[model samples]
Target: MKNTSAVILFAAMLASLVSCKTGGKALLPNVSGKAGEVAVVIDKENWEGSLGTEVKGLLARDCEYLPQREPLYSLVNVSPSAFADLFKYHRNIVMFNIAPDVEKQEIVYRTDVWAKTQCLIQINASCADSASVLLERNGENIAEAIEQAERNRVIINTLQYEETKLGDEIAKMIGGRIHIPVGYNFKKVTDNFIWIADEKQYSTQGIFVYRCPAEDEDPFTLEKIVARRNEVLKNNVPGMFENTYMTTSEYVVPGVRFLKYKGRDFVETRGLWEVKNDFMGGPFVSHSFYSKDGKEIIVLEAWVYAAKFDKRQFMRQTESFLYSFEWDKE
Candidate 1:
């Protein structure tokens, strides 16, 4: 594998130079491999040891808020000498380099190194133990980098195929920016609540936008948020059956996370929603924050229902639309 990769590298570099001469522009090939996959570049010996265990635990942990157990990332081992050509262009990669002369261990995060929008995390250490320590200390930060990169691609695609008329209404209503991708239409629109959905033969993807007076002193508490969500859905969202309304599922406890993105702070809540007196359920994620005027709390929620298929990527694709939050107040 090593020898073959080296030969492929020589040919790839030559092709790159030739492409540059043709248009006076160096166009990189689009990123390869499936989403949620990471290529771990290490030597055979080190990959079988404790350091590899730590790397897998960080990157391969199960994604949260899903109905079934699915790893956050599927890892493919690419030994040091075999990391060339095609494998070098994977969407996500974590590479380890240990040298005798290296005095300190450092973890570096890089993007678009060999492919556009690709995320590469490199760990430089003097030995395997040093690498393990670094991974333990910066695991969350590293995992977040990969996660952001994956979502960024989705957001980029969503921008190209947005729903303009719907965006205009959403902007006028909330005085802010959020992308509503194609294939969605307003299912219900009211003064304080809006429901948009894309219902298909085998799946259902929906988004809910809500605005309410910031009356509660502690508005972001778990109890307050869940209660508000249940109330809103109960009044607005209903099932196909008579007397059925949507509500938060209590079988599994709902969760909330306070995090920041692009200098904006918001609380993210995740849980399952089921219809009252009916047999319909799926996962939902919402981002809540105070509006610009500080007079109302705005919530953006996405949910997925694909009974016969995997929900991980489906939920991921829909939830990414919420992150395109830019205050469009004029």
Candidate 2:
């Protein structure tokens, strides 16, 4: 009877939490932590034990494109009891609950439970052994979910910024619009290509917009996309020296996947790009989708060049703009 009552109380508490909504407090920007940072709620003993190591390896592993060490997400571990109001409102959070009596291991995800535009992933495990097995099986899914949530937050924040003058300009040129935040300029514009960039002292973030005729045959295959990208960059994106131009790096093959965002279907690609005959290179991410009319294939890409600092934040900031892609209403 006592156990049943306890469970009932817990359910009621969770229900209350989900029901209670804030006016505008929770919708505001997450000011508690930096971009790509996650708050981890777990017990200290477990955090210091093997479980801790496993969790760190999965979430805090090194992010690509940084010269020095930089984790994919900077993790701030907090004991379950110490998870206070500040941590509750963070943008990204992961909590683990372990119990010997737990029937099975499971992962639960919730959004806006405590605050708006927040993602919380909780893992319940029967024991340490179960926890290990569960993490090994579902670690990738958890990581991907966290990343998607972060991207969503970025889109929301950008919209709130309301820097639509550049977006409107791009919409006029490309027949579509994407949120372009302040501090970016139209570096170059041509018939088939456009370059917008936010140039900084030690880092440079930019976006490339271009389009081509949509052939009846699918032109989005990996081979076709790479060929198109190479050709576009070669002609429009030049380098510091003669015969030198930006091209996709042959050293590391680009990763490609299909996804649907905001009613638009896109083939997303992530890869390194290099300047031929030059020593400059960095990472690039692109979204290739067909225009609303189905007559043209548009590619919106964000790339980063930050030699002295961590690239994760820079990449996140620029890539967020890609998610802002929206079709203009006629």
Candidate 3:
């Protein structure tokens, strides 16, 4: 009887978490579709015109730092007339409403409109031209909203099956908190650095956690961040062969941007990684930000190595765990 009661309590707690995440009183159905995919709703007229062209160009652009060309999002265009209940449950959605009756262009970004963890972006415009203008003005924001939605799904799943031991280890190692998925195993742990990876037959998803003194005269620059990673990975992360190590790719310069995400300021860097004197390579992303006391720069980074497959989703999934980071202050 006690065991059954415990199980019932756990189920209730999980349901409550889902309720909080979806912001709905009633339980919402789990979102459908694959990661890094979006369903676009538009009429056939706009589908063949410049509006669809622009939307495709924005959402389906080539993902950065991959060995092969894979779109940031695999878009499945759905005609509004054919958009049924199934399509409404997609994880990411971009819908267009173009009508003469629309007095002003309005863009409504809603979550959980039709399904849990769904990102439904409704653009109401007077015409295709006006819709295009709205998209052009807010293209970056739109993409980010979809990206966050994708990450939220990953974070939710991670929380449900989190490895509490790894979370405890991270808290001890770096004075930080992050929800880790079950498949990951601790690769290395030290005072200044920690490495964990989820290894599989087709892909390798890895993460590194470390801290710097925040003492660099001018820290948080691309040059500084890249140089630091090269130094750290070279000594710590080795390759298949002797003297081979991981380093930032010299061929492709990294890009860095300042973001205030989830109520904290951090510098996000995106670039490719290559094995020194070897052929293996893939993409990497990291977030660098100051600790609570402002004395140390806590850096959380994730990398993907999938030579046999397209790596956009792998990279996103690995890095999205970092987005679940929170301050586990003592």
Candidate 4:
């Protein structure tokens, strides 16, 4: 199997280069493999030992807001020699190099080393004990790096597959640009709000964009945001029932956090949503930021309704839309 994968990898690399040259422009290969997939290159013995357990615990941590306990990432363990041409281009990778002569443990991160839209994290340590210690200390950071790599992959993939007409229309209305993949359509559009969704047989993923009046007293506070969310859903998102509409689920309290990305600060909210008087419900995430003019609060929300299967990948795929947001300077 390892030899076969290596052969396929070489063929793909050759094909990509040839195609790029023929096309008159350099085109990096699209990210290969599924979202949230990670490749770990380590010796077989170490991978099957205590270090392997630690690696799995950290990288495969359970995801939240899902019906069943699904791993945060699906890790593929490959021996050092098997990390060849094609495998080198995995979207996310962690390589462990253990040597007795090495004195200190260090982690090196690189991007696009072997292919486009890839992240490689290398951990160097002197011995097994040192490597285990380093892993224990930096487990969280490593996991985050892997996760961020996938997020970046999503952004790049979205841009590559964007629907220009839909993107332009949304940009004009929202005063900014977002990568709306071709399959997504404008479900509802109003002066102050937009609802875009990718409807599938078993699930529906969506992105919601809206602006609300920005006030001095932290308009993005949890209390204020939830209040505004209910108002927006009630007005724009209607359910099948006579008096039903979408709103945050009261059964499970939502979580709020602050994060800084691409020089912008945003308040992020995560929770479940249910139709007020209907049985339909799912998970939703929103990122709120103040517009450049400071006149309104711009919030980008991504939600998923996949009742029949695990939702970790679905949520991650939709969440990438929020990160791809960029304000168009007027």
Candidate 5:
């Protein structure tokens, strides 16, 4: 009897240990340096088109432009939205490289832009020993050179800002502020998640909005989007819910059904879905929306699972989010 009791205790302890372990660790690919390189290529292409002759003229007037390997200004068409997408979705910095030569692999300029709009610049002359030596030996005024490069970046960013502001204004015209039903507050959580609620309002209606500018593709149509949402609901958690399409005067939205919670409506609408799978189990949501004017799309999405919590409580939370939904008026 003593031996049997000891054995049982050991088994219980082992089971407890196993239960405590958390699963779902993900190994993401390293794409850190790619954005900056991409940005440089884009900038070169754009400058080449817009002011290639003029810039070459300027370089000839100020700095030496060698036919063999000269540093000529050019611009590459980079989707502003794509740059934003990199920052918003990947949480990676978009860097610009202005290396003098392709073979050198030395970066002349490096800047990290958040949401493809905010910029942080870093330049190093040591990457290229030849260039560094030449600059140092000649005493070619490093401070002035660095200042000029930074000034160029400022000009680029200023142009980008003007474009973004215009886009925002257009978006506001399309989707006038929907107004978060009275009595709710926006609560921002760590790592970009937000909770929408009011003290008294119950019902799972909160919405989460994420900006992914790198996704420059056209927004998915209502039909295609609804289908994708249904696919997620069907495959991720089986037999617990059904998905259907809800049509409004302006748009068709996707909704999920809860078998556990009868007579509750769970609908979600967005212009784009920026899904991240390994973050909170699977298929975390990110969405964008455009105004009726068709200038900009506002995106709202959420990740809380109603299946994990009590049906009534989940419904209440959902309602609170939905009721609190609002859009910028201007």
Candidate 6:
């Protein structure tokens, strides 16, 4: 796999150099102006319109080699029976259209790199059947092109397969998961939180979460801890923390929040805020308990955040995550 990746990388580099020879001019014969240009046809007999505008956006962003906006050239609904012969002489072309009655979109993508052109047709439903057909300088055999194009289609479809698998796993664990909508600006999953059990110590779990704090709060202080806990309990309907926790008029640092809930001690501290402002908000809460007359202390720490989300939902999710914690016994 590593070697294959390396070869692909090298090939891409070589293709880029070849593509640049004519100052990035289109490599295939310019048929847009020629008479009787073969129009690539789409067979919508089995196609269902499942492709959404989001998929189109992804193609535009990820596959920049093909013209998307205003499409340099297009051939729509050319008779499918003639598609094979239409492009027999020309291997480089971009073809796209929605299937007749399908709810999703489908696109047939091909591009020229030097004299070799690769063709791939993808339907939102069965994207994996698409193949990347690589044609030699002489010409591409229609049968061989179709077979290879199917293989490439399968490769492209792997992405959807992995996504569906992960989505199923997440659905089994939690009520919901977070994902950026298709057209939104890309942002890292900073606000999402998860808890993972320690590898060596099966009973112990680390609480991992991120937050953007309010301007007045310092994430590391005891005061912040009390305030956040109280706020969480108030807004989160299923929260565990209640009035049993006492707010302390003390500070691990000045202006920091401190609190003790039940028998567990907690402190909140601030962190570097990256997105909204110069300062980012962060809170680390943990339970510390003593065994055998306070001789040994066991501290279980968790990161917390209150960022751009529904407070009730965030609290509920955080509470559920926190409840999964368990102490490891030696």
Candidate number achieving the greatest lDDT relative to the actual structure: 3
Model 6 lDDT tens row, 95-150: 33322233443333344433233443322222313212111111223323433433
State each candidate's clash count. 0, 0, 0, 0, 49, 37
State residue 312's C-alpha deviation in candidate 2, in Å.
Answer: 0.9
lDDT order, best first, reads 3, 1, 4, 2, 5, 6
Model 4, span 1-330: residue lDDT tens:
643453354355446545544664245565577778899888788899998999998888887665568998999998766676557667788887776555568987766655676787878787667888988988888887777888887787788888877667668876887787888988999998989999989999998998888875778778888999999999999998799999988887888999998998999999889999899988889999888878888889999989897899889989988888887776
Instruction: Go through the candidates in order and give each one's C-alpha lDDT.
Output: 0.84, 0.81, 0.85, 0.82, 0.32, 0.31
* Cα RMSD (angstroms) for every candidate in the order listed: 3.9, 3.6, 9.8, 5.5, 26.3, 21.9
TM-scores of the models, in the order given: 0.90, 0.86, 0.91, 0.86, 0.23, 0.19
Worst 10 residues of 2 by lDDT: 2-11
lDDT of 6: 0.31
Q: Considering only N, C-alpha and C atoms within 3 Å, which residue pairs clash in candidate 4?
A: none
Higher-TM-score candidate of 2 and 3: 3
- Whichever of 3 and 4 has more lDDT, that candidate is 3
lDDT of 5 by residue, 1-330 (tens): 533443344344335323332221132222333211113212344345533333234322321111122232222233323443342222122222223332443323222222222122222232234333433443233233333333333334334433233223323433322233334355443222233433332323344432222233555555545544444333332222244221111222333321111222223342212223321121223344443444533444543332233232222223233323334545
Query: Ranking by TM-score, best first?
Result: 3, 1, 2, 4, 5, 6
lDDT of 1 at 248: 94
Q: What is the lDDT of residue 320 in candidate 5?
A: 30
Model 3 misplaced stretches (Cα beyond 4 Å): 1-25
Stretches off by above 4 angstroms in model 5 are: 1-206, 211-218, 222-288, 306-308, 316-320, 323-330
